[model samples]
Target chain A: MVDRIPILKMGKYLLLSIQVDMHDQLALDLQEDLTEQIVRHRAKGVLIDISSLEIVDSFIGRMLSHIANVSRILDAKVIVVGMQPAVAITLVELGLSLEGIATALNIEKGMRWLENSVNEDEIAGEPESDEDTDAPSETGN
Target chain B: MTKTQTLPLKQETDIVIIRQRVRKAAEEARLGLVSQTKIVTAASEIARNALIYGGGGQCLIELANRDGRAAVRLVIADQGPGIADIERALVDGYTSGSGLGLGLSGSRRLVDEFDLKSQPGAGTTVELWKWK
Candidate 1:
């Protein structure tokens, strides 16, 4: 049996902290399960905390991008948070820019970004702004 | 300079083992945390290639002295079908498999030294070292 990555619901957002190094199958399972969680919860935002993940290979890199894309289609905003400096360097060196994915230095910043975006969606009177934006800022902490 | 540990790369689970071994080797080599992280991440990428693309292989982690500097070296060899074009394979965003095409090139960029050797129907061997 494949171990399921836990998806915790926080208000209108879903939070997932990847503490263990993910196997290929586990990463795939997380992608599928997370999408389902987003749809089920009808969440407005997703915060993925990866501080505990020491390395992110191409597969995991693609999975993160895929999650962001799918969540967008499902009308949920996704914010990736807590990427280690080394992991970020390796990701860029690996050529997986994770372009079109929003990132934050920590969960606190991610929450703030999500809050502002949600407010912007409300203010601009747009459908949550599928504007393909980058991270609000790179604390790189 | 020649102390080394070997791990078989026959399955997916071996990836974690390889990473752990690389981490231990890096620690023994006295690399800084950032250096250790880079090497481990590089090892993870190459080990995955050994299992998925090469159809399983073996990895050797070594503590070596390069130009009188301490370094951790990782050698991954596979017996599967070899890559047809080495240059194209090393280019970023190029993959024959369904992956993101970041395995070879990405691993190369992460380490201080990278070497690749392969021939059709023979096999492939990748050597990487990060000096401390």
Candidate 2:
């Protein structure tokens, strides 16, 4: 069996810390696994820690973007955190800006961002003032 | 000049090996963190192109000197169907395969020197040099 990266579940979020130097197949497997996990748990957000990766080539870069897009379709947001400075420089020089994927400096900050975004989403989804005014009048009666 | 080591580019794992070897050589040559990362990333890109587009091949890694500066050189060759339009292949985002098409062009940008040689049905060879 091909080795798989473990995904941790934290409340409404899923976390993946890629500690190994992943081969192409391994990366693809992670992509498949993460998406399935998102749907299974109905995760609201995902945090991918890539600080251990020394490099991010085009293939892996595309895989990250693919995961982000796929998770978005599943109603989950994906955030990549802990990218080393050298890897960041190399990735940009390699002509991949990794556009459309959110990034954070560390896992702590990533979780905060995820939590804040989820909260905002909840606030935006709440019933408007018309419903709130009705609730106050009903309580008075 | 150090001895050249050749590794097969037959599978995905081989690409990872190439990256590690290239990074070691780069560090030995005293390349800074970013330069080492660049060469390693470039090596990975070309190596994958060889395995995927070239149907698997071989890579030659060596340490050399250019103008009295130490450098890491890589020659990746494949015997698959060669590219007819080298210029088009070098263009950004022009991949004939399932990739993002940045492997060839982007790798060129990461190294100090880049060379490509290929002919239709004759195979492809890419030489990259990064100086320290």
Give Cα-based local distance difference scores for all models.
0.88, 0.92
Which regions of candidate 1 are displaced past 4 Å?
A125-141
Per-prediction DockQ comes to 0.66, 0.80
What would the per-residue lDDT of candidate 1 be over residues B37-85, giving only the tens digit for each residue?
A: 8899889998888788889899999999999988999999999898899
Cα shift from native, residue B103, model 2 (Å)? 0.4
Q: Indicate which candidate wins on TM-score.
A: 2
User: How much DockQ does model 2 earn?
Assistant: 0.80
Model 1 over residues A1-117: C-alpha lDDT tens digits?
Answer: 337789999888899999987888889999999999888887889999999988888888889999999999987899999999988887887778999999999999999999888
What's the i-RMS of each model?
A: 1.1, 0.6
Regions more than 4 Å wrong, model 2: A126-141
**Which lDDT value does model 1 have at A67?**
97
- Docking outcome class, model 1: medium
